[model samples]
Target: MSTRRKPQMHSSERARLDPFIVATGDASPRDQQDLMERPFFSLAKAKRVTPILYKAGYVQVEVYAVPEHGLATIWDADVLIWAASQIVEAENEGLRTSRFLRFTPYQMLSAIGRQTGSRDYKLLKGALTRLQATVIHTTIRNGENWRRHQFSWINEWEECVTRDGRVEGMEFVLPDWFYRGVIDRSLVLAIDRSYFKLTGGIERWLYRVARKHAGRQPSGWTFDIPHLHAKSGSQARVSDFALDIRRIAARQPLPGYRLDIEREGRRELLRIRPVKLSTESVGGTVGTLGTSGAGGIGTSGAAPSGLRAQDTQLTLWPETLIPGLNLESNLDSNFDVGPEDGGKPAPDGAASRSDTGRSEPVSPDDTRTREAQP
Candidate 1:
């Protein structure tokens, strides 16, 4: 007693699947704008979420689409699988398009626990449980009629669950459209640990911003942050990176917003000050609520050429000091490889350290004591 309609595809129509691409080293100019406007991308139009997160010197980017409405775990998985399909399809197309093609594996593992809140890794895998795709080849007959080629290909993929080491890796073929999108040169803003602490749901928010402002450069933007901590053992405070931004924005319109510091009084204001924020810090906060109140303060900078680099640290309470603070990391204890095959992960085996494990955050209690210690 099932009531599901079968999916149908036309024979003559050229199959158009979602195109996915990945570019490393420098961000492309075309793609660079996407990174700057990352805070405004829309999930409704793309039916997917493209997230970019950085650790140390590396920046990772991923894109996936959801076909359902309402927030459900099932829908999350569906989108992931859909994106994986497009990645695979795009890769196959590359073999024909170029003589020497190259691609990077999509690190879906970093995205899984991140995309799904509450560490529900199983749900992510479940959504893609029964995914399938068809590869069709076609030919032209005598210039008048187009005849279907005799070859047809179908492939099935499964979620690679690794818990101890590295997560499962997927090789993505860079399609022309997707390739062009990602190849645009951009300034890879480096991020630090503090950036992660201040932002939640940051990855998703950044995807939207980048998508919407794909082509247009901002006039100027500001980092109007309140409760920004300093590394120099002073009271936390609010300050804008306007000075730094202005330096970056030689003469264009700024592209950021203002943040109001709560908690009352000029004394409190004096206690809390703003330190100049960086792209990594800004990007980290996209999907997350900031260290302070409800909405954080953002600033708009006058348009300028090449931003100048500055070194200033915001001193917020460490994660351990914050009571009941819900911090998420790329690592988690629940991660596991598919149906244990042996004791250790195989060199060529499915169980890799990256897949089986995740990053751990500092305990709030531990942080509290350290700050107060001595």
Candidate 2:
């Protein structure tokens, strides 16, 4: 796809700002909880012009994008995930951070588990363009005097090229809204690194939903099919959406979780239970993008359950719902505004594969044995 060329440096641009260089090291992937629960990006990889308008109680979000660049897809979100991981890693070591980031295309692609081919590099540029172009308006983090707050995922981005036109480095400025959310440890969660392996759009979104909602709760989390369908901002019909969800449940694709599709009278419910992975540790990195379509079971036999319009955000599933099932409790619900642990810091947990190392499927646990680099 053709993308706009970066503008030539003008006189005013002569005063260059120093960028935060992305260092080589393990960066335990983290995601902003605000971004995890909401529909901020298009689920489909195709150029989508449809605007997303999401509302739940006081929370409201609207996303708009230009046709040329299209709304950023969830796959594009790996870049943001990478950025969040970097900020958290830097802060953990007491290093300073800024929205301005500088790194090589290969460094990013490899870290995100994408091939470092020429095409992959081109695709990276496209993702950056879409991120910079997409505009978001939301009242999610706004206080009592809530009003329209608008911003793009990125303020701007550019490539540093040699005289021979070989791109050597890249730089981008992240918006303050996103930067603040990521910098604040309480607003982040250490997601399963295997999340990058799931190749479906709905599947990927569901994993984030799982990480955000389930956390390490013994009861895990339960959401009726339709409730999830709406929150997903999926374009699929309800029937199709439920079927896709059922497929994911059957596959049990989400790492560190066991999924069971159950029924309560006419209601079909999905219960996510935290399962123990033999080597599972809280971890992450990045991955390639995938696309998905949507529809719904809106008028399906049963009425939808649990719109969850209350302010407290409590999990109220009866204890007797499931009996005698052992569940593991190792992860944290960092997504919660205030976790019980007060959001203690963790070392960089990224598990990016080395170029010379043979690639193998990441275990559900994402087990790592080597000591973390300084």
Candidate 3:
């Protein structure tokens, strides 16, 4: 199959959004909190057309994938992470950004640590295909009311090809919800660039979960394995999921944090601890991990003049057992959506919840990592 993208000179992108050229790289990676905590994508490289039903207190999410593209695997999320990093990087520099982004395929692939050969370019196209085809229904940032939104990861995407058939550039529009989430400072966190090195799906998801939850809080965070299983959105049974997590813990593959599986009475729990050695993680407010202004980082800027707030300690993030999040009888079902439900996802799908859990670390010395990559 050809990876060529015919010119998209006449698309909805022209009528509205002005293209923001991606001319910079080496920006610190940032991820959305709600997406990091929830089951937003499939975990494996294998094709999955199944639906992911997840709920956590006021948060609700349901994901459906078209059979042709299958589901967007967690690996595909690297695109979003790169997009988010670009947005936040520009914002912090006082520049305007848009959901519409234009860049060479090579720029993004290299930044995200993916191989930039012909086959990798084909995989990049595959990632875009899955992202555009996977549909999501969620209530993450909905105001005070109870409303859900249905949208795909990408509204549309296209590539620039010369008459000589050489691809020169690419562009894609992110869903509004995701764009807004990236723009909101409180919703994003800087992650280690080495996070891209992780190959296993579960470990990648676990690292994000740890980055979002454990953060720089000295005490770190921990979660019950069962609650962790439910929040993970894995198709594996609880026992298998627990085993997978235990193996990851044994390897401790998460970049800036340490993982330990512990037991109390009869229940097993996974703990996340931040290494005192790495001061590279930035969260919520502007901290040590903001972009380094490398390669003319943003298009706009004026040094800010004001009183900047600092976080003395972590606060108010949801817990594994929040008081009022009603749990339905069947919250743990790993269901699939066949061809009948694939073409069009129901906008008003049934709601589900995932508990936002945390764990405390075992020891500091054993987990001292090399700090943030790039």
List the global CA lDDT of all models.
0.22, 0.62, 0.63
Total clashing pairs for each candidate: 82, 15, 12
Better of 1 and 3 by TM-score: 3
Q: Could you give candidate 3's per-residue lDDT for residues 65-181 as a string of tens digits?
A: 998777787878878888888877876766556677767776676676555566566667878888999999986656444368889999899776556565566779888778776
Using all chains and alpha carbons, the TM-scores for the candidates as numbered come to 0.25, 0.72, 0.72
Candidate 2 displacement at residue 329 in angstroms: 41
Worst 10 residues of 2 by lDDT: 296-305
Q: How would you order the candidates by lDDT, starting with the best?
A: 3, 2, 1
Q: What's model 3's lDDT at 316? A: 17
Q: Rank the candidates by TM-score, best first.
A: 3, 2, 1
Show model 3 residue runs off by greater than 4 Å. Answer: 1-11, 277-374
Q: Which ten residues in a row have the lowest lDDT in candidate 3?
A: 287-296
Q: Of the candidates numbered 1 and 2, which has the greater lDDT value?
A: 2
Better of 2 and 3 by lDDT: 3
